[model samples]
Each structure stands twice: as C-alpha cells, then as structure tokens.
Target: MIAIVARSENGVIGKDGGLPWRCKGDLQFFKRTTMGRKIVVGRTTFEGLPPLKGREIFVLTRKPDAGFEGATAVSNPADVPADAIVCGGAAIYDLMIPQCDQLLVTTVKKEVEGDTFFNFQWLEGFEPEETIEETDEYSVVSYRRSGPSS
Candidate 1:
C-alpha cells in the first residue's frame, strides 16, 4: 500500500480537526495522485473532505456497521486493496503506516500548532526516491521501503 500525507516541520498535520495550513497546490497534488486509485481513509478524514469522484473510498471505522453514502466501510486494513492509497487523520495513519510500501509526503517548512501528526520515522526503513520543491512553503518527497517487508 502507499501512504500520502502533508505535515509541518514539527510533524503537525492537523489542528482542531482540520489542516493547520491552507495549501491549494498540495490539495491539487493529492487529487491528481489519487484520482484513479483506491484509497483507505479513517472516518474522520472522509468526513472532512468531499467525495473523491473516481476513486473507491474505503472508510475505516471502529463501528462494525458504519456507513457512508458513497463509501465502502471496512473495519480492518486487510479488507483494502494491496495497493490502496492510505490517507488519513492521525489514528488511521498510525494503523496503516506499518503496512505501507511507499510514502508520498508534502512537508511544510514551518512548524504549526496541531492536534494530529504523521508518525512515520522517515529514515528507519525507507529511502527517498525523489523530491520536488513544489513551492516555497512545502516540498514533496517520495520514499520507498529500504529493507525487507515486515
């Protein structure tokens, strides 16, 4: 699976249930990247954003019967596609990171107050394959697993 996220210098991704910063370009990047793929996301993350038009949305929630009008409800990570894109709020990121094969991150240069974060330790088991300076405020980096699969 692939994981995608945006975080600040201090690892902050959200504040008060939303992104701490407003970056339209990053959102566009996200949309373009995941447009034709399957995505696994937490309930809260699905709720915070509009439905992704062409992608299959898998909403992961603790509730066994949780339902969303346009999404498939999945209780376990095993229910998703092997190559699904794992998008998130912090809880989902925590659950899915270990299973990810690659990570696409947009890192904002400044630290921001936040209630959520991306906890993946970049250097532990991954190596950067490419990095693009998307803009002055943030840059996008792609990382592939460096060692054997867990």
Candidate 2:
C-alpha cells in the first residue's frame, strides 16, 4: 500500500481543516497518483475535498454513519484493501503509516500555520527512491520500505 500527502517544511499538513498552501503541481501529482486507486482517508480529510471520480474512497470514522455520498465509511484500516492509498489528515496518517509499503510525499518549501501535523520521522522506515521537482515551491519524493512490509 502507498500513503500520499503534502506537508509544509515544518510538517504542517493542515490549517483550519484545509491545506495551508496551494501548489498546482502538487494538486496534479495527487490526481495522477491516486487515479483509479482505492484511497483511504479520515472523515475530516474526506469532508474537505471534492469527490474523486475514478478512485474509490474509504473514510475512517467512529461515527455509525458518515453520510458522505458515493463513499464507504470504514472503522479500521484492515477493512480496506491492503493496497489502498492512504490519503490523510494527521490522525489517519498515524494509523496507517505502519501499513504503507511506499510513500509519495510533496514537501512545500515554506513553513505554514496549521493545527494538524504528521511526524515525518516515520519516513525513516522507508528508503528514498525518487525525488522530482514538481514546482519551485514544492518537490515530490517517493520512498519504499526496505526490510519488511508493515
């Protein structure tokens, strides 16, 4: 499975329930990587984005009914495909990182204000494989787990 996300240099992924910066290339990269794949996301994260058509969205929520149209609500990561793409808000990222075989991350060059953050230290578990300069403000990096599939 793969985990995809974009965060500021300071590791901020969200502010007031949305991305703190807008990078067009990162947006396009997200679309291309996740297209036609099953995407697992948290309820809050899913609520902020528009419905993705070609991808199946699985939302992790404690609520009995998320009421999100066109998406399935699941309580745990084990309920989805082992190969699903883990898209995020901070909590969901933390929950699913150990299950990820690969990580596709976009690093925004500047620090931005955010209430939610992910500890990028988890990236240490993966070996860096590729880095692409998607834009002047951000870069995309891919990493693969070296020893075992978590």
lDDT of 1 by residue, 1-150 (tens): 888999999999888767889877788899899998999888878888765799988989888497787899988778878878988878887788778878899998889998887785633588899995478878999988887646
Candidate topping TM-score? 2
lDDT of 2 by residue, 21-82 (tens): 88888898899989998999888888898769999988888974768788989986689788
Error of 2 at 96 (Å): 0.8
lDDT, residue 120, model 1: 58
**Candidate 1 wrong stretches, greater than 4 Å:** 120-123
Error of 2 at 93 (Å): 0.9
